[model samples]
Target: MTSSNIPIATPTFGQLLRSPVLLLAFGFGSGLAKKAPGTFGTVAAIPLWYGLQFLSPVAYLAVIAVTFALGCYLCGAASKKLGVHDHGGIVWDEFVGYWLTMFMAPAGWLWALYGFVLFRIFDIAKPQPIGWADRRVHGGLGIMLDDILAGIYAALVLQGTAYLIHML
Candidate 1:
């Protein structure tokens, strides 16, 4: 393999988190797999949720908000560095989107599944803000915005369902 192809540094989990390309590449890894990579990526987020939920809701929200903003910058940078727009492998956006989906929902496998399915649908469907972000926004913001919006929509659906089910 080419030296350029290899990531040289000891992979810093935090740096990877901050890297738009890494995130995008992760998502792409899911996208490239014959099976559902999106779902896999969403599943990958469960560990983070276990930790993030420990913080006060306000703290959690703040972290998510920061992550969203950082995602925009890093995603755009990585896309440019890789000389591609919205590469399939970048799944960091998926990570954040899934995080958004569970923001208010009762933490349960059922709710997560619902959020995951709903998030994947809206992400793929790209309706309204998702559509708008996909088309108009450029760079990392463009890459991540659509999924985040989808997350928001899915979160609503999941939360609503939870309310109806008396799970919230």
Candidate 2:
């Protein structure tokens, strides 16, 4: 059955705390927020992004790649365990997407904020292929794919903006 047909129920903090996989899938409790859990999850990613900035670009990309693969498993498994596909509480996708959005972003809090805003806009808007993937894909990959697309879109916009600023 598709996510639309599955009834969604938020997992309690105790439930999350008991399952390591669920905790990570839930963005280390950031997804526990009653409202805008995705936004909170993205916010939770900022500290990680800050640390990732010290890595070489290639290393950073590798980290994202690894995390993306992990997220596919984590998100999928969490959905299966919860009996709900793409539960809003499964925000691992947001963590990866926000990181991808900040890829190669200019080094500064301002740029980080810009990346956050851009990523949120693209993720929330879900234009074109992003929305398509969300509708068409299934399982953990489905949960991650849409956000990956959104991240790509946001990254493009963020990089372009940085380019413009430098050019001026």
- Candidate number of the best lDDT: 2
lDDT of 1 at 31: 40
TM-score of each: 0.78, 0.94
What digit string (tens of lDDT, one per residue) describes model 2 on residues 17-48? Answer: 98898999999999999999999999999999
Q: Give the local distance difference test score of model 1.
A: 0.73
What TM-score would you give candidate 1 relative to the actual structure?
0.78
Q: Tell me the whole-model lDDT of each prediction, alpha carbons only.
A: 0.73, 0.92
Off by over 4 Å in 2: 1-8
- Which residue pairs show collisions in model 2? none
- Span of ten consecutive residues with least summed lDDT in model 1: 1-10
